[model samples]
Target: MGDLSTTDRTRHRRLREQGRTGRQELFDVLGAGFVCHLGVIVDGAPMVVPTVYGFDSEHVYIHGSVASRSLTGEGRTVCVTVTHVDGLVLARSVFEHGVNYRSAVIYGVPRALEGEEKLEALRLLTEHTAPGQWEYARRPNRKELAATTILAISLEEASVKIRQGPPDDADDPHDVWAGVLPLSTTWQAPVTDPSAGHDVPDHVRRRAGTRIG
Candidate 1:
C-alpha cells in the first residue's frame, strides 16, 4: 500500500516525530476500533457526535437515522476521529506526563449511498463491529433500511498519529520513578436475556476474553 500524503491539513507541524506514515497504519488503527467521533457543522453551529464507523480500501462509512440533522451536515466536509488509549506515560515531572495512543483524523465530503450499496455499507458496519453478527442476526428489512442513512467519506485525505513506548523522562535526575501503566479492552462473557431465553450462539460466545483496541 502507498504511504499517505502529508498535505496542509495532515502535516504534523508539532510533534512531527509522533506522526505516522503509510495508509496501512491508518487501516490498522481503524480496524482495531469500532467507534468514532463525527464532527460537523449543523444549523450554523458546531456539533460533534459519537458514532460507529467502518472503513475499507477507499472510504470510511458512518451512518445514523435519516432524520438526524447532524448526519445531513450543513456543509460539504466533515471530520471523523478514532482514538485508542494504550497506556499512561508517567514521567518524573508532571509537564512531561503523556498518554500512549493511536489516533486518526479523517477529513472529506460525505456522499450518501443508496440501494444495494447502502445495504452493503450497513453490512460492513455490522461486520466491522461484531464479526459475524450480520449473518447471525436478522438482516434489516425495507422499512428499516429506509429510515437509515449511510455516508461514505473518502479516505484520500487523513491524518494519523501514534505515540508509544515508556516515558520520555527516563533519564531525568528526579528521584520519582517513571513508567508506563498499560490499559486495554477485552470482551466479557455474553449475557443471555431472560425474555428471549435463547442460549448464547457460538459466534457471540467466542468473543469472550478477546482483546479489543
Candidate 2:
C-alpha cells in the first residue's frame, strides 16, 4: 500500500521523469498482461526466457517443467520484466524516434513453492491467463504437480517505468511530420476444436473481442 521503496538497483539514474514510484503503478503494468520475460543464469550462462506468470499483492509466480534447464537451481537470483508497448513516437528525425510503453522490472532470489501453495499458484497462473478456465478445466493431478516447478519472487524489489504522449520535438523548428502511432491489443474470436463438442461458455465468450494493453 505504501509507495515502492527505492533500492540501489531500482534507482532511475537516467530519464528519471519516466520512473514510477507508486506500488499500484507496478500492479497496473503487471496486471495488464500474463506474460513476462524471466532472466536467470543457467550453468554460468545468462538466459532470458519468455514465460507466462501470475501474481498476488505480494509475489509474482512462474513455473516450468522440473527438468527445465532454467529452473534447475535453488536459491538462484532472477530478474522478471513485463512490458506493454502503447505507441510509437514518430518525430521529424530518426534519432528522436521512440516508443511509448509501460514496463516493470523485478529483481529477487526466487524460492520454489511446495504443497498446497504450489497448487494455488498453478490455479492463479491458469486463471490469470484465461479468466474462467481454472474451474472449467481439470485440475492438475499429483503426478503433474510433481513434474512441475513453481517459483515465486517477492514484489518488494521492483520498479516501473512508463512513457506516453506525443513526440517531444515540438520545440525544434521542423516543418516535417511528427506524431504518435498508437497501438492496442484485443482478443480475437476463439477457434474451437470439433472433439471438444461444446458451446463456448459465457465466461469465455464475453472476453472475445475484448481489448488489451
What TM-score should be assigned to candidate 1? 0.95
Q: How well is each residue in 1-213 modelled by candidate 2, as lDDT tens digits? A: 788868998998887989999999999998999989998887788888889999999999998652278656667778999999999999877777999999999998888889999999988988998898998888888898898888889999999999998888787777788999999899988888878888988888888899877
Worst 10 residues of 2 by lDDT: 64-73
Q: After superposition, how far is residue 6 of candidate 1 from its true place, in Å?
A: 2.1
Candidate 1: list runs displaced more than 4 Å: 71-75
Worst 10 residues of 1 by lDDT: 66-75
Question: At residue 148, what lDDT does model 1 achieve?
Answer: 85
List per-prediction Cα lDDT, in the order shown.
0.88, 0.87
**What does each candidate score in C-alpha RMSD?**
1.6, 1.5
